[model samples]
Target: MATLLLTGASGLVGSRLLPRLVEAGHTVRALVRGDVTLPAGAAAVHGDLADPGSLRPAVKDVEAVVHLAALFRTTDEDAVWRANLDGTRNLLSAVQAYAPRARFVMTSTGNVYDADATRPARESDPCSPTQAYPASKVAAEALVRESGLTWSVLRLPFVYGEGDGHLASMPGLVSRFGLHPAHTYSVAHHRDVAQVVKMALAGTLDSRVVNVTDDAPITVLEMTALAGSEVEGSAEPLTDPWHGRMDGTLLRELGFSPEVPTVQAAARAGIL
Candidate 1:
């Protein structure tokens, strides 16, 4: 098993993925900026992504680095850029200097795709993100692609499940953005996120940017209903039907089959 360094182990996705990696028999060193509880079996290493001097020991002697740390859903654009873009640059530099041959798996977002997509977003599509969060991610992805490290970038969709409150926030997002009720969104369970990370660590997705999503793209109406909330239905003409949706064909071609293949499946399994 690989000795892995995991960033953002206290965050929504990392907190869930950390235990899975440990249970899979990998030695996990969780990098934290402050006092935070980590899952059992992970060694906590004090470090800050914003401080380059603090990252060397965290990246030293690790076989892989799982970068799940990123800033999103905040109104502070400068903070978003610093944490997402500059932070990623710092981490990449540390990895190159300390663990030059380590497998680097960075999690990006599907929000990097253009709003007026003609179809589900693909890895090959040109990212034209206008928002601060996705724009930072797009820039971060560029750094990863050119960093000369053994890397894989997973552009994730709407991540939910395991009581992360992501689905619960859907109603407010719909209300705030005026999203259409029938607008579909690609989603993945936290379990599948772990599965994809394992695959990346195993070298199934090296030197590529793959979209990690489930079998179905669910609509806002269904998502809000799953969250025990409701949004008014609309029959208005949808301008960007494919917005927030992604094509998962590349990962499928690489033999990826999500354990929780749909949101409905997750609901039925009582994991949602």
Candidate 2:
């Protein structure tokens, strides 16, 4: 197994990923800003993404670096940009100085693609994100591509599982955004996401952007149902037909099929 350096180790996805990496016999050095319980067989390195100087120790001698740190929920655009874009640059700078030969796995959102996709978005699709979160990620992706390192970018769709409330909050998000219940989204379970990271670390994937999602697409109404809510009336047409759906053909081609193929499967497994 590889010696890995992981950022955002205390966050939802990273917390789940740490244990999986440990179980796989990989030595992981988790970067954290403060005190937290780390998985058994994982070491901790105190650092902040906003502080470049603090990241050196975490990056040193690691065979691969999985960067999962980013600001996903914030009203402040500057905060989002700083955390998503500038923070990535800072980490890359550390990687260049310390572990230049290490493989870099970036965690990016599928929202970076154009909103009005007719079919599921693919890695070759054009990017036209206008919002702060996705826009910042786009910029970060550019930085990673130009960083002179072996890199793989995983463009994730709506991820829900392992006690993450992302699926449960879907109904509220729909209400907040005034979205139609008929809107469908590509989704992936946290276990699948961890597997993707593990594969990236093992050098199974090439250096390219990959749309990572499950085989099936789930509707907003289904998500609401899974969240234990009831909705009434006919559904409205999707303004952006392919806003969330992403083609997982490349992911399957890479030989990593999802364990939980849909939100319903996740619910059945009690992970939602």
Model 2 misplaced stretches (Cα beyond 4 Å): none
**Most accurate candidate by TM-score:** 1
Encode model 1's per-residue lDDT on 1-272: one tens digit a residue: 99999998988899889999999999999999788887778999999999999999999989999999999888999999999999999999999999999999999999999989999999999998889999999999999999999999999999999999999999999989889999999999999999999999999999989999999999999999999998888889987899999999999999999999999999999999
Would you list the clashing residue pairs of candidate 1?
none
Cα error of candidate 2 at position 259, Å: 1.2
Candidate 1 residue-pair clash tally:
0
**Backbone clash numbers for all candidates listed:** 0, 0
| TM-scores vs. true structure, each candidate | 0.98, 0.96
- The best candidate by lDDT is 1
Ten contiguous residues with the weakest lDDT in model 1: 32-41
How high is the CA lDDT of each candidate model?
A: 0.94, 0.88
Compute the lDDT for candidate 2.
Answer: 0.88
